[model samples]
Target: MTDETDQKDQAVEKEAEEKFPIGGCAGAHAEFRKGNFGTFVMRAQPVPNIVPPPPIAAKPLPPNDEIYAVCAKKEIGDRRGKSFPLMRRWDDGKLRPWDIFIARFGKQYFAYENACPHSGQRLDWEKNNFYEPNYMKVLMCGKHGAQFDVETGVCISGPCEGQRLTSILCFVDDDGDVCLTGINIDLDADVEPVKVVDPNSDEVLENNGFKLQSTKREFFK
Candidate 1:
C-alpha cells in the first residue's frame, strides 16, 4: 500500500510539471514562495519606437544691389493691396526705414512709398488698412479723404491734386516673387525709426525736379 501511494504522488508531480512548464504560472508561483513576488506578476508587451519628420527650411535673403523679393506674387489678388516695411541705405551711409505698399490693377502691379503726397503721414490710418471701406477703385489716404489713381500714382481728388506718389520699379520674377529692381538698396541693413518725409521734401524735391527738367529737355531735343 505504501509503494502504491508513492507511485501515485510521483505521477501527480509529473503531470503538474508538464501542464505548467518551467518559467510558467506554476514555476512563477514557486519563485514567489522563494520571496520573489515580481516573478509571479504579468508583464506588458514591448512597444516599438516612433520617430518624427524633419522641418522645412526657409529661403535665404538676397545680397545688396540685387533683386530683393518684396513678397510672393500670389499674396496680392486683383484690385487688392498689401504693405511692407523696408530698410534702405542712403548715399550718406545712413540707413532709413521705408513703408511701401503694392497694389494690383488687373494683371499689372504698382508699388509706391506709403507716404501721402499732401502730408508726410502714411496712407493708412490703421495698421495695413490702405483702402476705402467699400470703394477699392482708388487708393485712399486715411488721414484726409484723398484718392489717387491705381495705374498712375497721380492724386485725382485731394489736397495734393496733380502730385504723384514716389514710385519704385518692381516686377514679378521667374520664381513668382514680386521683386524690386533697378534700385540701390541694402536688404541686410539695420534701419532706425525716423520720420518718413514726402517726395516734395527739400533735397528729394530738388533731385526729382532736376530729373523732370532733364526729361523735358531730352524730349524737346
Candidate 2:
C-alpha cells in the first residue's frame, strides 16, 4: 500500500513539471493545474533577451586653423550677451582656461574676453549678466562698474576708461552657427577653472594686446 502511494505522488510531480516546465512556485503550478490560469500564465512565459545599445562615438575635433562653432546664432538676441568658458593657448605656449562672451547689437555680433581691463576680474556682477541694467547699450563690468562699447569693446567709462577688452575673431557661418575662427583654441582640452589667468595682468596684456586680433572685419550682419 505505501509503495503504491509513493508511485502516485511521483506521477503527480512529473505531470506538474511537464505542464509547467518553467519551474517556478509549486503553489502556482498547483493553481495552474486547478485551472486558475491568470497568475500562472504570467509566471510560465519565458523571459526575453535584453540587448544593451552601443555607445555613441565622440565628435572629432577640427584642425586648429579651421572654424569651430561656439553656439547657435539664435542663442544671442539683439542687445543681449552670452558667456562661455574655454581653453586658449597663451603666449607662454601653455593651455589656459578663460572666459569669453558674445554680444549682439543691431544686426552685428561681437565677441570679447570676459575679463575686465581693470583688476582682472570678470565683467558680470551676476553670472552671464554683462549689460548695464539702465540702458542695455553697453557692457558693464560687475567688479568695478566699467562700461565698454558693445561694437568696439573699448572701455568708455569707469576706472579702465580708454582700455579695451580683448576681442576674439568670430563670425556667423552660412549655416547660421556662431563660430570662432583665426585663433588657436583647444575646444577638447580639459579646462580647469583654477588655471584661468588674470586678464589685466602683463601676461594677458602681452598675449592679448599684440597677438589677439579684433573681430571688426566683415561678418554676417
Candidate 3:
C-alpha cells in the first residue's frame, strides 16, 4: 500500500485500540462510534424495598392465654366459647398490648389483631374491641374506615383498598376455644398499638370503652 494510505490505516487501528482495549468489545465500540463513550459506565443494581417480614415465632396454644387481661365467657350462639386477647406491656409503662378481637360471626369465633394495616390504626371503636353489626361479614377499621373479612384480614375499603390486615394465625382448641398459633410475643413495639389523644378536644384515648381516655399519666404526657 502507499505510504499515506498505510499511515491512515495505522491511525485508524490506533483509534480503535484507544476506543476499546478489550478484544470482543461490541458495546464499547458502539458507544465510541456514537461519541458518547465518556458517559457510558456500568450501573449499580437496584435495591429492593428491604423491609423485612414480621417476626413470627412460636405459636400459642388454644384458648389464647393472656397474662394481663380478663378471661370472659365469650359466647357465639347456642355454643358458648371462652376467649381473650394476649396483652403485652410497652416501654412507656402503657398497657398497649397485642390483642385479638374474638367474636362469633356465623358458626365459629373469628379473631384478629386490633390494628389496621393502612395506618396501623386500631380496627375498633374501643380498645380490645369488636363490632357485631348486622349483615356484616368483615371487621371494620374505625380510624381509616377500612373493613376486612372476619376469616381473612383482607381490607375491603378505605386507603388500603386491596391490602389485607396483619393476620395472627390461630386455631381452635380442644375445648372449641380459639388461640393464636404463630405469633412472636416479643416481636418489637411497631406491631403494637400506640396511645393517642384527640387532636381537637382535651379528651385522651383511654382503655375505657367511652370517649376513651388514658388513666396512666405517662401515657398522656
Candidate 4:
C-alpha cells in the first residue's frame, strides 16, 4: 500500500478506538456499535428493586384493661364492619396507636384487632373493606390474601393459616350496644380516624362505611 493510504487507514482506526473504547463508549457501561447510527449504545441494565414501607404499629395499652367506650349494636350483615382507632398508654406512659375492628358472622358478634397476624399489617384492603364478595363471610387480608374466620379471627387460608388474630373482649351493654372491653386499651381521649389513600390514584378515598360524625362506625367484614 502507498504510505499516505496506510497513514489514513491508521488514523481512522485510532479514531474508532478513541470514540468507542474497548468495553464501552461511555465509561463502564458495556456498549455496542449500532451499524446504522454509527454510534455506541449502552447495554440493558436491571432496575433496582424497591421495598414497600411497613405497616404502622399499634399503640401500647396500659397494664389493666380499661373500658374505653361503647359502640352501638348494629346488625353485622354482608360486608359489614367497623374500625375504632384508639391511643393506648403503655408502661412507659407514652401514647401509642392501635385500632380495633368489630365484625359479625352469622348471629354472633365479635371484635378483633385490625392487624393481620401473618404480615403484621392491617386487614382491610381498602378503608375497612375486608369482604370477599361472598356476603362478607370471610375476612381477607388486603396485602397477601390471607383469609380469616370472621367470628374467631383464626386464619383459615393464606400464608398465615393456623394462626389466630389478636382478639379484643367486647360486651353487650344493657341498651343492646357493644362495649369496648379489651387488653390494655383505654379510649377515653380524643381519637382521629386515619385517612386512607388509594395507592393507584393517590387521592384520598372514602373509608368504606367508616363515618367521622356518627358514633356508629360501619364497614365490611
Give the C-alpha lDDT of model 4: 0.64
| Best candidate, lDDT | 2
The order of the candidates by TM-score, greatest first, is 4, 2, 1, 3
The TM-score measured for candidate 2 stands at: 0.56
lDDT of 4 at 154: 90
Cα-based lDDT for every prediction: 0.67, 0.71, 0.51, 0.64
Candidate 4 to truth, TM? 0.58
Instruction: Kindly list the per-residue Cα lDDT of model 1 for residues 118-172, writing each as its tens digit.
Output: 8876775444556654657888776666778987889888788899888888889
Query: Which residue ranges in model 3 land beyond 4 Å of their true spot?
Result: 1-96, 127-129, 132-134, 186-221
Per-candidate TM equals 0.55, 0.56, 0.44, 0.58
Comparison by TM-score, 2 against 3, better one:
2
In Å, residue 45's CA in model 4 sits off its true spot by 60
Query: What are the per-residue Cα lDDT tens digits for candidate 3 across 18-130?
Result: 76544426667688888875433333445677888997654333332432212232444422222233444444444345555565555665556656777776665544335
lDDT of 2 at 52: 88
| Candidate 1 lDDT | 0.67
Candidate 1 lDDT for residue 74: 89
lDDT order of candidates, best first?
2, 1, 4, 3
- By lDDT, the better pick of 1 and 4 is 1
**Over 4 Å off, model 2:** 1-64, 90-93, 194-221
Q: Which parts of model 1 have CA positions greater than 4 angstroms off?
A: 1-65, 191-221
